[model samples]
Target chain A: MYVYNDFDETFVRTRVAQFRGQVERRIDGSLTEDEFKPLRLMNGLYLQLHAYMLRVAVPYGTLNPAQMRQLAMIADRWDKGYGHFTTRQNIQYNWPKLGDVPDMLEALADVGMHAIQTSGNTIRNVTADHFAGAAADEIEDPRAIAELLRQWSTDHPEFQFLPRKFKIAVTGAAADRAVTRAHDIGLVVVRNDAGEVGYQVIVGGGLGRTPMVGKVLRDFVSKADLLPYVEAIVSVYNLLGRRDNKYKARIKITLHENGIETIRDLVEDRFNAIRAGFGGYDQTLLAEIEKSFAPPAFVTKATDGYEAARLANPAFRSWTDTNLSAHKAAGYAIVSISIKKHGATPGDATSDQMRVMAELADRYGHGELRISHEQNVILPHVHQSDLPAVYAALRKADLATANIGLASDIIACPGMDYCALATARSIPIAQQIATRFDELKIEHDVGPLKIKISGCINACGHHHVGHIGILGLDRAGVENYQITLGGDGSEMTTIGERAGPGFSADDIVPAIERLVTGYLDLRRDPSETFLQTYRRLGLAPFKTLLYPSEDKADAA
Target chain B: MPPRFTPKVVTANALLDGDAVWLTEDDHWSPLMSRAELITDEAHADLRLLQAKARASEIAGAYLADARLGADGPEPVHFREAFRTRGPSNYPHGKQVETPPQT
Candidate 1:
């Protein structure tokens, strides 16, 4: 909900003009494909399988009503009338033309948005918990720092071109909704014993060909030293990161090659040198940024009425039970609008639905929306008094799905349908799974389960972190799927281990059903969740159901 | 027989006015003979037609000649060269080049 200042406005406008010139040069042959590739990537323009795709950044997944309306307008005017919200909290238009990308950038700039660094080997969008400011258990609002990092990293000359793309995530809540541990750099804001706020900085964690949990470089870095510390870390990676091969170019690989102790010492040495030069500039900037993100004043209203309404309407009660989270303010709750409608594509919202969300955010909640890392929208602050009205509006828009963390609320990437690099279809697989689970009426019985699917090894779907992860691949011109179990994408993050042999695309869904049924039967109590049972028993029991012959031989 | 490579034509969304067209053959883009003449088919008839057009003597001559223009002016010169050369401001055939009067 932060408005662009004159400086911000001028910067984006100038960037758009520069890119337009670059595009013109590319079209006229002044720039070759090799030269133009990096330039286009810097602007978030990608040449996918069939057409060009443009990805626009929604910083820290926060958007005002006006911004959401602008996105709707862009989708209708420029794209195929629908925008795909990504797991990274960005929106991608899959069918943009190459020549019109400059115009698209200009349109975004007009709305105080840009696609800069949304792609390419630079520091990408800084993500945070969707319910950052509104979460009741948050030690501090993560977006304040996230926004500061956004400004500092934007067009940073020194780190603009890295060996590979970098991602950073921050979370202030203990529950770790931001998936902090799975990022190139993760920062968890924590208050120490003296009530002084600092960040617990974690480094070297990422999901891709290699998956490793970030190691803690600093247990506590003071609030003022955050920017300098980050700069030092990035500088170390920039200088020492592998450039010989694209596959091993990430900071994770660098950390792996060089011991963590060595990297930590180098980062600390760099931080000490830069910390003195920072001289409270970040503190002043944070104060100004915090003013823009200040929580709205809430009236002390009676929530007994809301309780009565919930008791009267069973549907409302179910929705409130599943979708609502405790708010920091009394008599308020943070609501997550589920986009996972059964049998529909995941992470896609029609323009009309977007407008409806924009209207609701402006009228009922604080005129703000946050797109979650799970591809859902969060109306961060809504008063208890207005729950009934908001619920009714959402129902009218068909945005009132009661499933939040249930089986049907799956996170999937735009796989073979849109991505050129994808090996098989992910959206249809997620859709079929959701539909099958809905038909079975066993979703609620399955309890909290995260089913993440990636079309390839890119791990864009965060498949490595799902409780039941499905990875799509191509085998001898036929589509095959691999399943992994015991994954967790939370404060306690762990990469799932692959189970037995890969299943053919036809055999995947049945295999998943078999595993779920196995969990149901093997569980000591119905209270045991899928992940709990998987972790307690390991992959052996699930493998028995999935690969019965292999299990028997192993048992022998 | 393998399909031939033909340029695919595309129009700017802003300039299309819902009447523009392009030809795509073998991943290459080229200007169509006429926006109205170009048509889509359920069975990839347009792609076949584009491949045939790329092999036509007249189209091949124009494509080679356009390459001589050296990255400026009309691209993949064909009947649509007039539009690309003169700009859509002077559509339906006009002088290819004109200089403004000295200020």
Candidate 2:
């Protein structure tokens, strides 16, 4: 909910105007596709397989009611009647016309949002935990730091032409919902032994064709030194990162080739050189940004009505049990409205659905909303007394799926369906899996599973971190899916290991069903989740479940 | 011995709308793959692709895709090209919106 100031507003308007001229020039044949391609990508426009895709950044995954409503309006007026909320907490309009994109961007700027830095080699949108301000275990709200980074990274001259696209994530809480370890740079707000609040700086983690858990660059850097410290890291990466091959261009490969100690030494040298120049200016800006994120006033309310509703409605109870999270404020709950309804495309919300969520946020959620990296809409500060009302509105809108961490709640990329880079269709696979699981009615019983799918090895879907990861590939001109097990994107980040041969598109759903249903029997108890069980037993059991024919041969 | 030439068609996303379009026998960009000029010869396929790429103002990322001759027109031989011919399976958008019968 960081409101744009005069400078921010003017900057966005200037960029939009610039892009409009560029689009016109491209159409008029003044600028060739080669010249215009990079310019359009910088503005977050890409010509995909079927249409132009515009990725609009939702900075820190935060939106006010007005901004949410404007997004709905934009979706309805232009392109399709819905938008896909990506794993990066940004929204993508898949079918935008090239001529109308300028207008769409202008509309976005009207609500202090833009698609700037959502694509290309420039620093992408800085993401944070969706439950930043509201989580019970949070030490501090990470949005202020995230906002500071956003301002610093947006159009930063020196870092714009880095070797590869860089991603940064910050999390305030002890829990790692932001997938901090899988980003190029991850900052966890922590208190040192001296009781000074600072950040645990992690560098070089990424999850594309080559996945790596970030290395700890610094134990702690005081809040005042964060800007210079991060700048030093990027400055080091900018010079030393691989440029010869695009595949080896990310900072991860740099760290891998040069080792973290060497990178750390260089970063420290750079940090020392630049530390004095900062002059606490970034701290002053952070203080100003913090003012916009002040928590809303909480009202003490009776929970008798909430308790009564729970008793009266089993569906409401079920939803509250799964979709609600513990809020920092007393008598408040963080409501995660599942956008992944059974058989529907994951992360897609229609204009009507968006409006419904906006209205509900206004009525019961303090006019604030959040888009989770898991692709769900969150009402961050709903009072327990208003839970019933929120639930009712969500149910009416078909947003009450009551499946947040269950088997059916899958994360899937646009895949070959829309992406030019995709080798196989991911959305259809996600849909079939969810629909099949729903039909079996074992999602809740299967318990706390994260199934993530990516179209290719780019790992935009974060398939590397799912408990059950499905990667779609083109094996001899046919769609093939490879399954991986034991991946966890938590405090203990682990990359999933592939389980033998791939499954055909027709065989994949049943294959997944066998693996998940097999968990019910393999687990010590229902209390032990999928990740815990997989850890305890290893891939041997799950591998057997995934490839039963091999298990039968072994038995024979 | 050279590999057998696969039948192919020139395809690209339209510059204005970004919808998938194929170069027809008349050298016009048609949204329908059926109207595309199928090239059986490898040299002709490469030449047609180059011609399509030259029309940069009208299209972007023009390339040749594998296809086969059908009763009405050319049919996509690969699933990727087949998806491009209609639209995404998730929704009735894109070419599916234009031609509802196929959807």
Worst 10 residues of 1 chain A by lDDT: A45-54
Pairs of residues clashing in candidate 2: none
DockQ for each candidate?
A: 0.03, 0.88
True contacts kept of 1: 0.00
A5-81 per-residue lDDT for model 2 (tens digits)? 99999999999999999999999989989999999999999989899999999999999889998999989888788
Tens digits of per-residue lDDT for model 1, A282-352: 89989999999888877788778798899999999988988999999988899999999887788888899
After superposing candidate 1 on the true structure, give the runs of residues whose Cα lies further than 4 Å from its correct spot. A549-556, B1-103
The alpha-carbon lDDT assigned to residue A533 of candidate 2 equals: 95
Task: Residues B1-103, candidate 1: write the lDDT tens digits.
Answer: 6564333333221111111123333423233323212223323544544454443211211111111122332243332333332322201211223321211
lDDT of all the models against the reference? 0.80, 0.93
lDDT for residue B93 in candidate 2, whole number 0-100: 81
Which candidate wins on DockQ? 2
